[model samples]
Target: MTFSPTTLGTGIAGYNFLLRTRATQQAALANSPQVARDTEHFREKLKDIQTSDQLMEDRAMLRVALGAFGLEDDLDNKAFIKKILDSDLADSKSLANRLADKRYLAFAKAFNFAGESGPQLPDGKSAEDVTRDLAAIRTADDLLGNTSLLRATLKTFDLEGDIGNTFFLKKVLESDPTDPASFARRLADPRYAELAEAFDLSDKVKDRNTVYGFASVFADAAATLETPEDLLEDETLLTEALRVFGLENDVYRPDFLDSVLRSNLNDSTSFANQLEDKRYAALAGVFDFHEMAQAALAEEPFTSTLQSFVTTLNARSEPVTTSNDFFSDIKLMLETYKFFGLPSRSNQAGYVNRILNSDRSDPAAMIHGVTDGRYLALADAFRIEEPNTDRIYPPEFADQVVTNYLDRQFEISIGESDESMRVALSMERDLGKVIGNAKGNDSRWYGVMASNLLREVFETVFQLPDSFGTLDVDRQLKELKHRSESYFGTSALEDFTDPDRMEDLRRRYLMQSNLQSSATSSSASIVLSLLSRG
Candidate 1:
């Protein structure tokens, strides 16, 4: 027999009639003690509706009611109602059995079963137990499926961007709900170990922010972290943190140093007091505020003295008009040098003899004889131009000499000499022909001259032997060559006509020269000491 909505409605009407009849019978027995007891029992059942046993009983009653409706052949309610309305059922028992089968099939389908005869839990396990297991399964699915929650969880350990990590996802998915140690095992995986250690997730972590704060501490360490576990397992993090705070080199008390870093960084008094600890006596040299201030104060006179020399040199009259004028300028510079406590009288006499005797037309001969340190210091101080090898001194030669003098003088005053600056100055002088040709034509001359100067500077500067042997000169040269090719192409100087190109070259040259200058210094103290001892 087939059932439709009409037949189901008729069944509902019959069920209502049965309820009314039962109500009438209960009313008739209302005065009886048994009826009152039954009523109280029914009220108790209503109150216990949320209980597992009550819920199970309610489900059973619902199944029975659906079975009696003659619409149990369909799994879906809408489909069943449609069938019921279209069908003509004459036998009530047959309809009830078919409806019961349909209702059973629907329950099986909803629970991922094939039919009424479906897989079930062991004898001791109830539907409630099955439901709890299903809930756990759903939770695991949600954890994997919901990207936001997954990202948030990873973010707590500074691993938010590792969402696509298959191993992490697999481990998370495999975590057992029943075993508390299961999650620990997954987190203990070496891949996630750093994160676990940083976040202190080995134990219960209540606040997400606390995990992030701890993670940040490790990330703030100097060396790159391979894994979160590296934060604790390796000395790299501790060493790097100590180095960053300037406590690495002289720190002798490891325990005390650790305590200080872990303390509040904002408390200057606490940090100052830590420095006073006798254990950190070595750091006293660096931390001595009074000594540092005194040293800084001591340099003021030297700085002022150098400034005065620069001003005097800048204000000196040009004395290269003739041999006699040049000699007069030299005498004046000698007196200035004497005033500044630079050249000895003998050195001055030697310089004068070299200048007077050397061919007046030959700058190279004149400078070649004036190689004494004292003479070099004085010549550099007074901004004296070096005579070019060419007999005739062009205006370009004068400019080159002035530039070289100023550069060397600056180096001397600072008590440092930069090999790169030396190379750059030499290269600038060597490129005199190229610079002379470009002069007075256009502003592009500056750019071309500057780029050529830098090209030679980098080439010569990078080629020089590294005093510290720390720089990878070869790699730097390769990178510089590549950058030069990319920025200026193969013919940088030849394309100097373009104003934009020239400007770019000028900017690049100045930037590189400035950077190189900072790293390079002219103080060959070790060599000088060796020479003095010899």
Candidate 2:
């Protein structure tokens, strides 16, 4: 039987025994003596154990039981209370007692310096390491405790890490200073102490403004770092440095760079003059064409000259800006270059085809424009729209054309830019002269080529003098035709005696002559007449 500690300690069991005997005797007497005796017996059967003598006599035994169950009530015996708490068997009354006392609950969390075990120390580790470890642990503990100390510690340690990375240090300085103290703490970290020394970080006061201000200083100092990757690693520093130096807004994106290179075909001598590095001495530094020519200029001036001549011829291609202007402008640009004596119509034609192919304009229009006579007409068309025809002229045309192309034919190709075009044209004309020199009265195939040229010239003028209205188309055409047939007899057309063949020959002669006359303004009357007769 379980007993209360108060009952055992005070010996109250004997008083409860007498009360129990009286209730039982009263209940027994009633049942034995008929109905009257039953009432009296029922009153004496049950009794309170609180006043029992038996309970009092068993006091020593009760005490033993109390002690076994950790029920000792002495105030100094905390061990008993602890044992009660550790017991597996639950006693509601004991638990109630513990809840009534708040002091016991508080004591559990309190550190016991005298007897409880503490964290162990590391062996063979330096004092500094040990200190840091303890600090870290404390910091973590503080964090869990919801103290601001953890945030402070984080700021302090971050600063330390940054000190070791100069790039990172610059970034920190340039970064927005949302937390002035945190930024300062980070900069003061021992690892960054050297960087701070170099940049003089201490001069700046602790404020949000100063964080970015200090960052600018670091960025400027860090500009010495080479390579794009190095700059990227510390973007904060680079951005700050770029801002302070006014380079941020000036930086070119991909599109801008492409436009810059494409617009300046010739060397940007003025811009180049500003650059100190020889590697970037010219705009040509980035262009492959210029680089090849530049190399040639150093090693083989002749080769470079030839290449440049070829390039000028190719470049004569009129830009395909609009539909109406496409073909006509191309034709004009071509003849303009050709009249100046550019060699090989092949290169000029090739450039025009390329521009059209790029879909800058309709290819059909471009083809028609290039093939059409009256290149100068196309030139006028472009002049109204773009007005930058001066660039289209080979560098030599700061002066005149026809006389220059014929007189300085070889010199034309030898010189640079427009000179090449003039020389090429001159060479074509001189080739006529050479044919003339070779034929000298023998007047066979040699004289036929020149005669064919005049014939074509005259027929073109006779057909459309209005198209070549700028010159005396009729007069020039007739004179050229008369001179051509004078050399090649009427037998020139004798070979085409068949009626069908003669008709076809006439159409071919007229078409070719008209196309050539439109472009040159000068007619190849002799050439056309020879072909007509044949």
Candidate 3:
């Protein structure tokens, strides 16, 4: 017979159930007409299988019939219906009796049954009772055997990553679920403390309230202390003090607490004695005590010398130009030295003293005493002319020397790699103006220094794998133009085209090409020598 839409329910679940029943009936009829007849007869015998006892009997009968026919009875509705249809009358009755006695319906409803239908339990057991049974079934073996369930449980505690970890699994399986102390021991372990915290399963996990209460107690006790000595005798305060510093386990150790309390914070020796303890090593290492002490001792003299240097620079009136803040200029110079990882503070002080003590009329004397490797690099970088004992620089030469030194250092530190060459070129152009402006400027020392720096840049570039033409000339020139304009205004471009400056640049380029040729020859000679020796 064809079923109408009205005969089936409107709900999705009810419709699905009826469809499964129909499918099962069709399968049974296909196996044998007798199986269909038996299913109809059984349905007639039970008007409604609504009760727990009735459902239990039905399930057992179904299992027996399906078993006889070698048909599998799964949790699905179709399988359940098919099992009942294939059951033998005699076997079905006997199996139903056993199932009802054992309360098999409750187990089936809890685990096997599908959909949102409420489980029909026996009169004494409620839904909660079935839940309790399910919870109790979670033995260590049961959990281990069910990987999905075990993984889900671990995920609930934010320990999902630890799932399948043999060591962690072993520890978890070893802990007795029934023993509160066993659970506490696992929770107390720092390794599992985070998991315990995620699950809200540990009483020892301190919350804001616990911290506030501890703080309140400490504040009350500390308010009564007239001196640091008062902390030694109070046992309660001492215990809390230990707990405050995460040394709660040592609260009972009076000797440790007494030693902590007796130690004077003001006395360096007492503080050092406390730091000798392995426990305080981590805390002690947080501070660089040696550096702090050295800085404190050096503070006064360093400040005085810096002030004197600033005063000397400010007093200079010759070579009058803009941007004459010596303090800021000298600070920038010092920072540049630091950036290059050269010249310790002692050497810096010596340099500063030399600059301050040298005759303001001739600053070339300041370069005389610098024989150190670090200072030699600075001299080369700045193109500083070495001092001649008989020759004295002009009065205005001192300002140029100091200005050139600071500018070169500042540019090298701040400029990009290619921009360093651009800066040297810009300096050459600018210093040319200074040389040209001076009366009887026969020395042309400033022009010479700038040309020397430019030559050095060319030498470096020639050593590189790429030629100047192959390099990112557009980007380099753009950056050079921007920096020069920013520092020396737009007029810097005009200065670059000066006849004398152009001639100097041409000469410097030739010198660089010659030097590269010489270097290549020297390298070839070394390689030939090594081959000859071989």
Candidate 4:
């Protein structure tokens, strides 16, 4: 039944019961009438101790004294003890120490009937019945003050069968205050240890449900795991710990590696193998591994873990079969990899080819690859060329594609794959800008040979893979003109690409490019134009 706060009468009753049951208390009281009066005085003081509200230390002290008195015989005694326990104490530290020292120790010894009196009852065994139990008490000094019972009943009794008697077990540990090492030994006694361990494990499971949360039990185990090596070394315990590492007890699953893999990639080739292994493919076909990778990359703890995962994907060398979902995942992985500055060169080139070669053709995927910006620098660095051909889309068409792609036209790809439409377009656009901006005396000329080669490759794609002429160049030009006007206000396109304004354009482009070297010109057109304008 539920209990309210303690009353003064209840507190006094509880205190008196403690004195009656404790063997030391009973013996001490019986020493004289003065001792009995002292006990009653202590009870009256406790009534004063009971304030308007409950206190933790007070409750604990009351329970310890009550248990010491062996008042478990009466239901009213139980109520008194319960109220004391249920009381909310103001001080926790005082309570922790008090309960540990006073109540807990006394309650524990009460089970053995130390200092109890009277004859055997009709309903329950009396003080004599406690002889065998008292034999179990690991007492150090009597009230008369003499040492006895070093090993006590703990050395002989099988504690497992007496699991219900945890009170005495706790006492045996607490009774010898000076001997912590011996105390630990008794607490870890194999029979008692087994029951305690089981109870603790069950309680932990009830408290924490997730795999991550359940993993905490192992963390606690890791703290004070010293023992008879056998229990600590048990395979079952290790397996439970390993499961938290994502290893579902099988090498085939990617999570089968250490949960540490989420934070450290250099740990094993096994992690790489599972990510790259094609056999145990993702069964939940719609889910993207990239989502998990992205989240990991975004968090510091998971950074290296995602890096290792990406590194593994890069090494796979084969395309994860493309469904709409797989393709989307591949895109996400590429974007995440690039954002983290971990681009895979061979994989990018290869994955692009695979996308181009895929049965399910999509143009938007190409747009995604170019705008990610990671490979734009690479495209300029490598000067990678398209093969021989002569097709050329107008500058405006290329510019519109660049603008749309840059304005977040598509979500990025995440995997380190060799196939993506966006990557191809990015390479093409970056190459085009390289060519369009090329001047005889321009730094853009630095990569002219590579740009020319790339132009040829673009032409080849146009003629053989797809026709550039089929693209609506004129419409694209109009759209570009309109956008430029909208941005620069009506006159933005006026003489914008005019040869007459080439000198002005060159200066503007040079200034905008943030080139360290100044652009100088010997052209009479610029000089004459400047003079005439002046």
Best by lDDT: 3
Give the TM-score of each candidate.
0.15, 0.14, 0.17, 0.16
Model 2 TM-score relative to the real fold = 0.14
User: What is the TM-score ranking, best to worst?
Assistant: 3, 4, 1, 2
Ten contiguous residues minimizing lDDT sum, candidate 1: 1-10
Q: Which scores higher on lDDT, 1 or 4?
A: 1
lDDT of each: 0.37, 0.32, 0.39, 0.33
**Candidate closer to the true structure by lDDT (higher is better), 2 or 3:** 3
Model 1 lDDT per residue over 1-534, tens place: 111111111122423333345334334433345433433343334323332233234533222223222222332454443333323233344332245223332222222111222222212233333333322222334455656445644654456667887466545555443344665344544435443432333222222112122223443342333222333345644443334223455335555553443333234555533554322222222122333335466764222222332344334433232334445556445434543234356666555545544553575777555533334333322233343321111112222222232333332222223333333223333344343334442322233223434445445333434341344645544455455566567333445445566545434544555555444433466667789999
Model 2 agreement with the true structure over 243-263: per-residue lDDT tens digits: 322234424343332233233
Residue-wise lDDT of candidate 3 within 401-454, one digit each (tens)? 223323333233223333333343354544444344333322232223234354
Model 3 lDDT vs. the true structure?
A: 0.39
Model 3 TM-score, all chains together: 0.17
Question: Which candidate do you rate higher for TM-score, 3 or 4?
Answer: 3
- Determine the backbone clash count of candidate 4: 39
Alpha-carbon deviation at 273 in model 1, angstroms: 99
The number of clashing residue pairs in each candidate reads 18, 70, 1, 39
